[model samples]
Each structure stands twice: as structure tokens, then as C-alpha cells.
Target: AKLRGENGCPWDRKQTAQTLVKYIRNETEELIAAIENKDKENICEELGDVLYLICMITAINEEQGNFTFPQVVQGINEKLIRRHPHVFAGTRYKDEEELARQWEAIKAEEKREHRQAAEKREP
Candidate 1:
């Protein structure tokens, strides 16, 4: 979203979410094709294009004061830590079933709280 700010590039400021949709999709398709063709050069170029578009849109979002890209990254980092408590919290899992159960229990509780918050916001 930094690129879409008032102080960002003029080209980014001109773009809307509607405008960049097909461009990103096309770049992803090209990358997939390059991967199937085993062309490292083409894949690299296409991946760069896709990443650029992602950054551009994120810059726009940040400018709107919704949330910054760092927030997005940090949220994911926190989620990884939460999900892997065996590593970060000294918790141990005896089996995959236990791990799955723990993950689902946490996710369901989080969702229930989120739903309650949303319901509270309703008139």
C-alpha cells in the first residue's frame, strides 16, 4: 500500500482494485505456464510481476488506513506461533490427531468470539 499513497508513484495512485484484477491474474497464469515449461527465467520474471501487483494493491490499502502490510505479515506470524505451540510454548503433541484437535478447538473458540463481537455490533 505504500506505493498507492499520495506520496507514492503516480501510476499506482491512478489504479483501482478493479483495474488490477486481470493484470495479476494474467501474471499468475504466465508463471504457471513457465513452471510447466521448466523455464526458470520466465518463471522468475512472471513471479516478480505478480509480487509487484500485490505490493501495489497493499499500498493502496495502507493509504486508506485500513491496515498496513506489516500488520498482515505480523498476524500470520502470530498465527504460526499459535498453531505451533509445541515449538513456541513448550507444548508437546503425541500424535497428529491431538494436534488437529487442539488446532480446531482454538479456531472454533476464536470464531465464536468473533461472531459474538459482530452480533454485538448489530442494531
Candidate 2:
């Protein structure tokens, strides 16, 4: 909050979600490089950078009344749990191919549900 406040850094204050896309890409690339090279320290640093960019983008949207950081966190948590029924819900998959198919099917069902909900919301 302070970073985007009236008294905060001008660069930070001026950033928008769109403007941060390049930084996100660069940070992700750096993170991939760190992982490939097995540089644990750089990997951690790059992870932090990527996480910071995500929070910054979330904060920007939050200020615009679009969504909050907690909503994003909750969304991913729900998605992970929903997608991994084998681990969380005692569902069984025989092999990698079966798991991949199940994952896609779950995603398709979620998309269908979302579309239905959106249709219901529309006038």
C-alpha cells in the first residue's frame, strides 16, 4: 500500500498491470535460468522477484476495485484442490495419461460451470 501511496516511489505509483507484463516475463525467464543452472540462491531471489511482481499487479487491480490479493490466493488454492482430486479427494488415476485426461476433463467442467454462472448473472 505504501508503495502506491501519495508519498511512495514515483515509479511504483506509475505502474499499471499492463506495464508490468514485461517485468513478469523477464523475472520468469531468470527464474527458469536459475533452476536450470541449479543455483539455489538465484532461484530463491528470482522467485521473490516473480512473487513481488504478482503482488504488485494484484495491488494495482485491488486499487481499481477489480480484485484483491486474498481473492487471488483463495482462487489458486481452490483450483489446486479441485484439480488434484487424486490427492485431496481419494480419486484414483491409473497412470500419467489417465491423470492428464482427468485434469483436462476437470478443467472443461469448471469452464462449463463458469459459463453457466456468467449466463445466469447476465440480464
TM-scores, all candidates, are: 0.65, 0.90
Model 1 over residues 13-114: C-alpha lDDT tens digits?
A: 899767999998899999999999999999999989998887777776776787788998898898888777888999999999999999998788778888
Candidate 2 per-residue lDDT over residues 1-123, each given as its tens digit = 899999999999999999999999999999999999999999999999999999999999999999999899999999999999999999998999999999999999999999999999999
RMSD of each: 3.5, 1.8
Among the numbered candidates, top lDDT falls to 2
Query: After best superposition, candidate 2 residue 106: deviation in angstroms?
Result: 1.1
